[model samples]
Target: MSTPGEKPDTRELVEADVVPRSRWRMQLVWLVPIVALLVGGWLATKAVLERGEKITISFKTGEGLEAGKTKLKFKDVDIGVVEAVTLSTDRKHVVAKAEVVRDVANLLVDNTRFWVVRPRISGGTVSGLGTLLSGSYIDVDVGNAVKPRTDFVGLEVPPVFASDIPGREFTLKSAGLGSLDVGSPVFFRRLQVGQIASYQLDPDGKGVTLKVFVNAPYDRFVKGDTRFWHASGVDMAFDTNGLRVETQSIVSIIIGGVAFESPADSIEQVAAAANAQFELYATRADAMKQHDRIVDKYVVNFIDSVRGLTVGAPVDFRGVVIGEVTQIYTRFDPEHRRFSIPVEIQIYPERFTSRYQTGRAGGRISDDPKGIANYLVENGFRFQLRSGNPLTGQLYLAMDYFPDAPKAKIDWSRSPPELPAVPRTLQSLQDSVTRLLTKLNNIPFEAIGNDARTTLRTTNSMLSKLDADVIPRAHDTLASAQTALDSANSALQPESSLQQTTEETLRELARTSAALRTLADYLSQHPEALVRGKSGGQP
Candidate 1:
């Protein structure tokens, strides 16, 4: 310490040795702080190097999410944690910041999927039950894509399948979603083969496109010609073939599902490529029907009632279905003041060709369909509306030979060439009755009745005269006959007087004969007395 006024010792102090202050000496007090600072810096560097990827996930809502508490998991293994949760600039979504472990940082790719795990039910599935006890976490699905991404959109629902599951995804286009939803099961031959991965409405809003995954060996059965249909609820049909009930399973009945199968006749069993697009039919019958490439349209005009006919009604040729009714409309002829029913039918010519094996190969009908039709019409081929279901009053168009049908000409100039039509059998019978009644109505019934009444009166008068004149004469004749019979009976009696008189006369004659015999004997004795013998004998 230098005194305030003592300057005389300064010359002697530096003369003994010239000493230099150490350039880099750390003070003891600062030693602890330096060491601590070094350690803190090392830790910060290590954290920067060993820390997982920092990612932000956008969610619709902050439901089932928490900052610093919710973990990020892959296959139920903790790989990261949610560090912060904040709202987006537009306030439309909740953005979660997460730190993934360095070990799995490579898995944060553009295709990696993230979703909040929560207890929920969808499409007949109960998932995330463990989350109820353990709290919600961010679920991650690792992606194979090499492109790294930090910003992501979280899914609202769990994925239908895991990335590691061996399967092929397919796209199905349908008129509507029906009962199908994400996670809805997909069936192959009623076997649970896959589930619906996702669905989106078509751009034009005309239909929906669904993505489905068929697992492993079942995926091998997905052929190019495989048909898909909605197998939801019960498929009950009552038709010409009779009642048919079809279903996949009880699960399908409750939550709806999709089913696929190749036609039994199909030979193309090659596995379909991934994401193959296919049409989704409403029912199995529709899906299984053979596609017809050849179509022929015609119009049939009927003068009779088409009460039970409808669109899609079968157009039958004999017992075979050749076509279907497309449309039915009424036409009025102003000049004739008459109405006619015109039915538009779409015929599958290939159906006829294939069934009958006609014309040429490859199911080709005759080159001249018009000429053939005209010839058939000339040969009495006509269309008639016939009842298909009596109870339901459903009608179908029948094409058959009607040799007795009235001759008619086909007007080929119409948009759809007109085909000849005959009245249904019932209608024809009604017409016959109407004509018979008309003929009976023409008879002169009043004149006939008057003539018959006059004849009856004349006959009755004649009969009355006969009865009054003939009855008295007939009774008198009968009485006379009876009297004659009584007189004859009395004459035959033994006690009558005439009978006694006759007996006495006969006795006198007998006495005279005896006297004559005695006189003859005396005459024999005396010849002279012969003449007077009889007198003497008498005397």
Candidate 2:
């Protein structure tokens, strides 16, 4: 404070600088806050940049899916996000671009599945509320180790969560439509245990092939003799009464399923070297094949047999449906040099086999030649044509087996009884009708016309006789009898004096005849009738 000049403060300033002043201050007030802000900003960017393994998923439709907002989740935890959406080359599928966190990469196996988790309410479960928040996404599931960068198939529902069981892949060739599709369920003992992986047709177009995957444990129970059948869609039928059809939930319809039954004695494992081909039979097809055996197939060569045939007509073996007419067709047989009809029939052999097994060793029930001969000797087999539908004029084949009658040998040298060669199915009914018309043309028209004329002439002559001669004669005879009765009644009337006199004379004659017997002895000869006739009876 001594002087305001600089020269005066130099010593004081120097002394103050050398010693310095102990002052209280806030520690890093601005710098601390700035450093905190930098650290927080850096952490936020790191969190946003965190990424996952990328994968591509495909779907049939992308109606509700979104790219940026859609999140890939596993067990309710967000594992990845959809990065982009694009159409496949075929334009039939939606390809979803997804990125999964690196930590989950080891879980991505070949068996991993991706399916859209949409809002679903079924039997008793509801899921997919997150989908409503950010749209649909390709949900992934980690499976066993497999090839890297594998394809992720978008499922319609969660892959049936199951462990790998002992199973085999079989290819089935079928003419009709398959009962299963990709993702269809495979049932064991009526329980859902497996699913169909894929389906396609062979290159030659001969049949369809299906790939099936079965879960373990249950797979051990399936044997080589296991039978599989379609368990989809309700079979529907309608009759004159009302509608008859099966109904099921919408989910079961879209996903075709299968059911299997294992045979009692079948082994657990199938033959490993057996061909990959497996045979599956529909209910109707199985029944049809069973009918093909045992029954004798015959073709009718005459029109009479065909005109009376119809669908559901009895194809009987002794009045039984041993077989049925399945098909009939008319075509020219190039080898035969003539146009002919072919008939196909299906027979059930079980009927005969059952009976054959029940008989003694030497009995007539066996299929052996000797047994057949013995059976024929004991029971005669014959066929008789009978009317099936009287209104439709349809005919059926009936069989008669008579155990009481003696068997007759079939005469192979001579032509058998003529029958029409026609199919018993609906399609062949038309051809049968045509054959009937042709047979009618062979009748003699002139003979029929002459017989009709003769019948008419005889009827007219009889009518004329009854109207003229016979009727008049009966009327005249009745008139004469009436006149005679009237004359007799007139003479007997009491009002006339001659009637009273005749009555009195009849009474006197009765008394005179009683006394005449005694007087006749004295008179010797009393000729009363002769005297009366000569008018001398007055005495």
Error of 2 at 361 (Å): 13
lDDT of 2 by residue, 1-539 (tens): 66565456565554334666567654677788889999999998887766567888888988667878788887778888888889999998999888888888777788787888888753223577767766666666666667776468687665444334345555555555455556677765557777765667778887677656666656655555566556565545332113455323344455556656655444456542213555555432231233232444444432233554444455676545666666565656579677754444444545554542644343324546434533543455544455655555656666555454434553333232222222334534667777888888888889999999999999999999999989999999999999999988988888877799998999999999978975665355556544544335433
- For model 2, what is the C-alpha lDDT against the true structure? 0.61
Show pairs that collide, candidate 1: 52-100
- The per-residue C-alpha lDDT of model 2 at residue 10 equals 65
Clashes of each: 1, 15
Residue 405 local lDDT, model 2: 43
lDDT, candidate 1, at 394: 79
Task: Give, for candidate 2, the lowest lDDT window spanning 10 residues.
Answer: 414-423
lDDT over C-alpha atoms for residue 383 of model 1: 93
TM-score per prediction, in order, is: 0.80, 0.48
Which lDDT values do the candidates have, in the order given?
0.89, 0.61
